[model samples]
Target: MPKRIQSSGRNIVLSVRDFCEREKDNNAPLIPFGNVRQRVAAKTGISEKTLNKAPTLSSTKAEMQNWIINKGLSYLPTMVKAQLYKIIKEHKEAPIYEADQMLQAHCHKVARLPPYHCELNAIEFMWSLVKRRVANKNVGQETNNIVNLAEEAFQSITAEDWQKQCEHVRHIEDKLRERDVYMDAEMDRFIIELNNESDTESDSSSEDSSDSDYSSLAIHMDHAYSK
Candidate 1:
């Protein structure tokens, strides 16, 4: 069983490092930074001269170009191509589990909720109730007693309460899906309207140009007749 630890910055980093170590021991293909840099250089066909002039990892591509210029080096096509390749590679490799083989190793699947959607987690609701109960209780001064009270608060939430929270989350998911569908339809309509407006404006401009041309021709004919 995983130990229930406080979510401090150092603790979180330690936990991630431990998880990574375990995954590494299991023969997970975790690419190192040096390997990534070498791969980026090889795949991009960027020369060492341009790559050497690049700024720190935190700097943007444009900023890196500026840095290169500051170092009396031009940001050539090779550097720009390398930057693009780096961005594409980073985006493509963003997934935590890259291989389908990794998923086969685990018996039970982990359901990862979308980012910023904490309401979908039944544990969040359970924690809220537990914290409220703990706040109401007068477990004072003793560390062991406070721990006991906190434990008791957690124990108060039943399986039925978890089921209800799950149902609530399903309802929220349905509503969100409905809203997304509506927004997509609205976006399609808006794009069509914009295209129609553009076409109409183009036609009006062409008609105006044609009328101007005709007026100019009439003036030229009049000048010729008078002469």
Candidate 2:
């Protein structure tokens, strides 16, 4: 295993020896993510066309607010969240996780989870199982007793148990996909009904206006899938 590096130059090839090892894969040049070397900058000659613009980086909090107002945006908090963050985030390169960088140094690529979404994780379901087992079997609240119970609880959940949970999630996903087909047909029907009669809101809505539950249902797939 390669010695894991802790930080920057996680992305950099500082020396010729590193380049030789890296170049063995292919002749693709190391594209540095940070400031270019003076020699490199001179050769490349900064072009007018840039990848992304960082308009808000240097601005104070007050200046960001002013920019929001000048743009005739909505509520302060909402504008900051919906609009301002996009401007700042789009300009930035995503930071590599320290643990991920360390692992990559050892030639093991990590499979990253989608940020903030865990409904698809079978391990989450397995965790609940383990927790429930521990709760049921609790003999004492002592540290070692709890630790032993937790270990046994984890061991009780086999590979097959995990596979079952994965299949459960898959079934839910299949159902949602079928649900999407229904929603798509409904949306098309809605559009057709809206302009079938008149341009005005009253005429558009009143045309074949039967109660539609799509609005009332408000079926959040994320919430449903978690259950």
Candidate 3:
């Protein structure tokens, strides 16, 4: 729900704030400047100072907020973010040149980034699929046989299977786009309802609130093979 605007002289912050307000859904997380800093510190394990020096991403608070609100949300878990803070803070006392190097190493280990990418994410989907297909029975008692089973499975995927998978991805992408549009429209409708209810407080209004709750992509992503 957060967006980045060029850090405008006076108007930039306000525009960002206003956009957030207009578009915020009932369940949207708050995206204040202070909250963003705290979240970043929690995610990177680096001191705010060290995070400031991060080059892969811009350091501006709005940019950070936008990145997290959009891209990072799927990758970084709350627990992981806290651990990142610990790793960076502990390593910050090292000499300047060494500090960056140490922090970078720690970051790769700490940052979960995207939980899934193109459905290939090991934890998100593929691992479970493999387990479901093969885990119940041992491939073999010995290591070599297990490796052979894995290689055989990898080689089993055929052209027809790949075509079906591509079609499935396209269908998923279309559904996701529809869901986003529905959620956005729902937010606007909810706000309008809220305004109407407030204005008609003295009168007994019986209209049912419109149900705009379309399932979000997060739920789709989180819901893989359930244990």
Candidate 4:
């Protein structure tokens, strides 16, 4: 994990090493999620606390929102998530203010969506779908072959199939929105009560949009393969 970006809300550190070890225990298979995690964290250290703080598989939709949107994702408040991410990955030291300004612009341009309304950005499901579709199909062992395989995978699906997938995803999203509305209402009431007691002007913030939720969703997969 990069110490530079670790802060109140924006850090979601992934443990590629543990992910690799877990995959090793299973039969070796093509797992892109674990591979990406390993690639991202190769030079940087993995912090146990950051990874462990992630909600477990059984977490409810409301809990997931509280952890991911309200607390976990640093997209809010700070603003410059993309630049900060670049600094961590590229090992370039830059002003957080620049990143902050960039993020503020993004937030300004986009309307916030409820947490549960964005099933299209659920990366874990996408990884499973991709791996199942591409398993055992060799695009050769060369780099170009790998690139070709990715292109083929995207091109293989029909427009109708894509529409069906998006529709199904949207159905789940509707359910999520209902849950979020109920939860958000309760939270808002609590905040109002607190403010009434304190009698101070509370600062307002926006929720993350559905389209932008892609970057925050975490997917874990095994990456051990014959190399």
User: By lDDT, who's the top model here?
Assistant: 1
As for lDDT, the candidate ahead, 3 or 4, is 4
Candidate 2 per-residue lDDT, tens place, 80-186, comes to 43366555554444544547777999999887556665876778888898999999988557766988899999878888998899999788778878999987875
Quote model 2's TM-score.
0.41
The lDDT of model 1 is: 0.60
The residue-by-residue lDDT of candidate 3 on 4-74, one tens digit each, is 55534336445555555654663454445567764444443335566444222223444434444443342
lDDT of 1 by residue, 56-123 (tens): 46667776556555545544566664664454343332234323335657664656778898977777
**Pairs of colliding residues, candidate 2:** none
lDDT (C-alpha) at residue 208 in model 3: 44
Instruction: Give the lDDT of residue 99 in candidate 1.
Output: 35
Off by over 4 Å in 4: 1-118, 122-132, 139-144, 184-227
User: How accurate locally is residue 206 in candidate 2, as Cα lDDT from 0 to 100?
Assistant: 43
My TM-score estimates for the predictions, one after another, are 0.41, 0.41, 0.30, 0.27
Would you list the clashing residue pairs of candidate 1?
A: none
Local lDDT at 64 for model 2 = 57
lDDT of 1 at 150: 89
Backbone Cα, N, C clashes tallied per candidate: 0, 0, 5, 4
Give the least accurate 10-residue stretch of model 2, judged by summed lDDT.
Answer: 45-54
Off by over 4 Å in 1: 1-106, 139-145, 189-227
- lDDT value, residue 99 of candidate 4: 41
